[model samples]
Target: MDARRDVFQAIADPTRRAIIGMIAQKPVNVNTIAEQFDVSRQAISLHLKILAECGLLNIKQLGRERLCEAKLEKLNEVHEWVAQYHKLWTGRLHALKNFVEQEALQPRQANTDNKKKTKNIHKPKK
Candidate 1:
């Protein structure tokens, strides 16, 4: 059985996420990717390795250089996960809006009723 690593764990590091973003635009060699970061080449290599293991990247050897390419399909998992919460928060916000509108209307309605009661009390009986 192929054990799939969690894409979230691989992308948890800021460097790894940056690396993914960099390669997403186009394929790049390890040295090119390393140059963009403050970290050492070894550190960048480790990040690349984690990303590959998580299925977020595809590394290939072309001539002497190892090229890293992004396999963005893996990100669909992350998107699906976030979409659930997006829907939940949207529902919660709609409920909050309805509550606020109802609260606003209640005060106006109560004030109108109170005004009518006050006018009735002050009026002389017919």
Candidate 2:
């Protein structure tokens, strides 16, 4: 079986995410990307490996230089996963809002009914 890394695991690192963003605009030389970070070039290369495994980054060799390009379509997995939860939570929140509004109105309705009852309470004839 092909041992591709999970996209979620790959993006969990802030550095990797930054690298993806940096390369997303345009393909960047591997050395240029390494220079932008405080970490060693070796460290950046490891991050690059994980991103490539996740199918989020593509590395190409042109002459003696390697260029990294962003392949963000893989992130649709993350987006679809998040959208499911978003829909679930949105429904829950809407239900909670309706319950709270009903609870709020019930108290006002009860007070109004009580006031009307008190006004109509007949006094015993003197």
Candidate 3:
């Protein structure tokens, strides 16, 4: 898979997202991360590998332990892409606001226009 695709796929999983969220709080070892999940250590390792490959996680070895930290800067790709639409959305929202204000200024019909008086209808002899 492409690098961007791998990153997108890695983040698509809720467990992986939670792992990233946790690491964003602080750098932690493999075992610490594994403990947070119900899956096996090996499974967590695989998820970490995918995250690292996507540049969303940074792994460094300190003595015998590998510390995984979130590399959230890579999210700029997504941020930049979404920002392009932000301007367009802003314009559309402004237009919608103007439209709503204009509509609200229109005159409203009286409620009695919708109500029928019993005297207006023909009545059967009792």
Candidate 4:
């Protein structure tokens, strides 16, 4: 059985992420995609291959040239995963805000207590 590549694994490399961003704007030929980066065509090709394996891109051959097109729908998996944490963190933050606001609304009992203690301290050592 063939193992499927994870989309997150494919995008883990900065080069691969950049390639995805570039192709997402429009379908680009391999040569054009390679030219944008400082890396060799071979390295870029490897990145493209990984992205293709992850289902993040579709490569179509046209005569001698291969055009790479972005298949961004695969990213929905990543989005869904992140959205879950986003909700959790947002709820936690909201709860924290409410707690802080409630604390602020209460009277300055600690300050009053400190003042009472200070009054006793000023009265000479009985």
> Residue 99 of model 4: what lDDT?
95
The deviation in Å at residue 20 for candidate 3 is: 1.4
User: Residue 31 deviation, candidate 1, in Å?
Assistant: 0.6
Evaluated at residue 123, the lDDT of candidate 3 is 58
Global CA lDDT of candidate 2, please?
0.92
TM-score of each: 0.91, 0.87, 0.73, 0.82
Could you give candidate 3's per-residue lDDT for residues 5-111 as a string of tens digits? 55667778998898998999889998899999999999899889888888899889999999998899877876787798998899999999999887776533333
Query: Which RMSD does model 4 reach against the true structure?
Result: 3.5
Model 1 ranges off by over 4 Å:
1-4, 124-126
TM-score of 4: 0.82
- lDDT of candidate 1 over 8-126, digit per residue (tens): 88778999999898999899999999999998889988888889988989999999999999998988999999999999999999999999999999999999999999999999998
Worst 10 residues of 3 by lDDT: 107-116
Name model 4 segments beyond 4 Å from true. Answer: 1-4, 107-126
For model 2, name the residue pairs that clash. none
Candidate closest to the true structure, highest TM-score = 1
lDDT (0 to 1) per candidate: 0.91, 0.92, 0.83, 0.90
Candidate 4 has an lDDT of 0.90
Error of 2 at 78 (Å): 0.8
Q: Deviation in angstroms for 70 in model 1?
A: 0.5
Error of 1 at 36 (Å): 0.7
